[model samples]
Target: MRSIVFASGKGGVGKSTVTLNLGLTLAAAGKRVVVVDADLEMANIGILLGIDATPISLHNVLSGENEMQDAVYAGPNNMRYVPASLSPEKMERLDLDKLPSAIKKLDDSSDFVLIDCPPGLGPSAVAAIKSAKEIVIVSTPEPSALADALKVRALAERHGVKIVGVVLNMVLGDRSEIKKEDFETVMEVPIIGLLPEDVEVRRSAALQVPVIIRAPGTAFSRAMRLLASRLSGEKLAIQETKVKKGLFSSIMEFFGRIFGRK
Candidate 1:
């Protein structure tokens, strides 16, 4: 399987969100994709997918209590995933060295395995970096976030891993944010995708579904699908459609319009 690690130097940059959505999109395209929640301490992928209780998790697999296959769960769009546990106790028992071997075993059955790596250059993140053959860095257009993303890119280079590309998430089309050209110049990497700051993303997370499935027609979702297609070696022409705004989104836009009139 082609192992890809989705990583970020800073948290809340939507690394996990991008990982899950990309996995789902690939699965939708008939690829056997498995997403591993490598963030052992703050394992929120399960929570995000509304899978709060799993008898076997990545923690169990790492601790040698269960095989990696035991933790695999069926997800939306025919995707398979191995979610990490949220327990602090499980965190202490994780064998970081076992990660690469465990990931290797998955190669026999999957077309692609996407690991949702934790933020920063911690042991867990390093383990994920070592396991993955290619890396996809996730970041926002903020200067601080881009600076941290540069650190991650340097780390990947030090380990001699190929960087698939960078995914710029939550773009609001504001002048305050870094431009795509500037971001690419600073990181020395191509921008594979630019996901918009759409309200449907927040709504899908709240509803425990990927935005690609919940709002497939939205600009953000279309970008995700195109990214997946490119990664899977398929050049698909994806067209953006109007976002189906929810009541909360409507309220937010209304308030923004009123505030701007002053």
Candidate 2:
């Protein structure tokens, strides 16, 4: 089994979102994928997937109240996931050092164990990184996000972890955004995927469904599937889907329709 961690140096870069969608995509393709919400402190994978409150979570496993298998829950697309508890007390008492053993136990039945690591180089993120054999760094096209992504790449290199590749998310195609070539040059990592700034992404998030399922033909969804196929070492003949309008353009069109403007 391959253990891959989705990490970012800063929050709100869509690390968890990407992890969930990618897991679902891989699972749909007949891979036994297990996604673990390794962000112990601010765990939101459960909430994102609309999973009900469970009696067992990663917190239970870490605290020795239950085994890692007991915390496993069935998620969308037949994917299995281990969600972290949102309780502050549970987060405070979590033994991060035990994470490696718990993660190792998942290898028996999984083809890919994707960990949604917390943002930054915190204890939780570090533990998740140490547990994974490979890492996928997620970042936006903005300068600040790129800077943070470089930090994450450095951290993985320092630990001798293999970097699968970098995923550039929320690509608006604005001239101000950094070019893909420059980003690859600066980060010293190949770009595996580029997801556009599509409104479908926000709608999927609000609906608690992955965009790959909610709007499969959208630009973002297609990009996600391509990324999944690449990671799974499968060559896919995915057709290019044109993005009609970006998030901002769509918003402006909404107001234009309201005012009856051409």
List lDDT for all candidates, in order.
Answer: 0.86, 0.86
Compared with the true structure, what per-residue lDDT tens digits does model 1 show for residues 27-87? 8777888999999888878766666457799999999999988989998777899999866
Assess every candidate by TM-score.
0.89, 0.89
Q: Rate residue 142 of model 2 by lDDT.
A: 88
Worst 10 residues of 2 by lDDT: 239-248
Q: How close is candidate 1 to the true structure, as a TM-score?
A: 0.89
What shift in Å separates residue 197 of candidate 2 from its native position after superposition? 0.9
